[model samples]
Target: MDFGSSLGPIRPRRSGRLGDTVVTYLVDRIVSADYPVDSALPTEPELCEEFGVSRTVVRESIKLLEEKGLVRATPGRGTRVLEPPGWNLLDPIVLEAQIRHDRELKILDDLISVRAALESDMAAATARTIKAPQQQELADQLDVLADLLDDAGAYAAEDVAFHELIMVASGNRLGHAIIHSIHSKARLSSRYNGTPTRADQEQSMAEHRQIEALIRAGDADGVAVLMRTHIVGSWNRRRPEVHRSLTALPTVE
Candidate 1:
């Protein structure tokens, strides 16, 4: 509850709102388990003093945390940290923190699993509904991706674009938004190694070409199966790197 030392120095942000700064500080502590679940958080006065912020800013930060399910503030017992299941992983701040914690937990494997499931469905749906320019766009993306096979950074960007285009073309706006959010967080995390080897790029390109062919042929079932296979295969190829990251992380007590 007393996170004074663990919370580190409270330097004011040069541009952002003080409340948001306080929120980031609290969210980081909560996710890192510096303020363990069910433990009482420092009082408003204590937080105010610690962050050198006003009661209003501290109060706003705690409110935001509550909205994200990171804590529950009781009238008399004060605020208490909640367990991971209690938190809203869809919340961007929480998602970022979750990915950070994932380096140790291998939570990205679970995320990839979910992504595979969603993308398979998205691919099938898009294949069913894809139109002229979008279909053409998907076809052209493969060529662009192939050309960038030697450029890891460029290939990664195109890889993201290729997948995002499918999701958007699926006409499932909500699904696209969700996948976009997932990729955004995952891309920022160290767990996602965006730089691929030449072989990896070639493999990805081949799978994508199959995906394009399936979509163009209107093979929904084939696209679904291939998409799932592609996702799992890609992750399997990088399993060693992922395993290394997991093993090297210091175990959180």
Candidate 2:
């Protein structure tokens, strides 16, 4: 790798920590295939010189990369980039890098599938145990969604809020945390959000209404199926045509 040209010096402006900035830089390079799997990374001295950081910062950044399963540093062999399968995809920084570099949309597709699975179950649980107050909450949220139909950006934000309400109603903290972490990062990718037409927003709102109705009626199975279908179908509609061959979740009947 051309450390001087391709990878520029780190700026003086501090973000969180110097180590974090360096980690982000290296993670982007590794995930983007600038440093391919099985290839050794630049030496510590080279990295230190390139980023203009001290040896301590570089070493700590390397340790952070190892913790994320991005690279392995052997005493005699230097650091070697690891395969994607070994990566901690749940880590926010690593996941963001992967999503940013995902040209074929495979990572986004898989992200939707995982989201569908977890959120569907959460929806079902909410439906089964939701009280009258919780049902009213969802109904009010649906109203808010309907009102925002004209503003796609605001509607998109509320769309996430509506789903989060359901997840909270389900009382599944772990599930909520996992989805929140991944979805928060995934939303930063343009491919993940896509460009929603007015018709698309209307369709999504309609699905939200149906989901609310099912939850109100305590129809767990129906809500689960609809939630899964809604998520995967939304992704299908927005996904680029060229990469449609990638596997997607099947909608439950």
Q: Cα lDDT of all candidates, in order? A: 0.82, 0.87
Q: How many residue pairs clash in each candidate?
A: 0, 0
With a 3 Å backbone cut-off (N, CA, C), the pairs that clash in candidate 2 are none
Q: What is the lDDT of residue 66 in candidate 1?
A: 97
- Model 2 stretches with alpha carbons more than 4 Å out: 1-16, 243-253
lDDT of 1: 0.82
What is the Cα-based TM-score of model 2?
0.90
Which candidate should be chosen as best, given TM-score against the real structure?
A: 2
Would you give me the overall lDDT of model 2? 0.87
Candidate 1 residue-wise lDDT, 1-253, digit = tens: 3334545655666423778767876787788787999999999998888778888788888889999999999999899998888898888888877777665436678778889999999999999999999999998899899899888888888999999999999988887888788778878754576446799988899999999999999999999999999998888776644454343332211
Q: What TM-score, over all chains together, does every model reach?
A: 0.89, 0.90
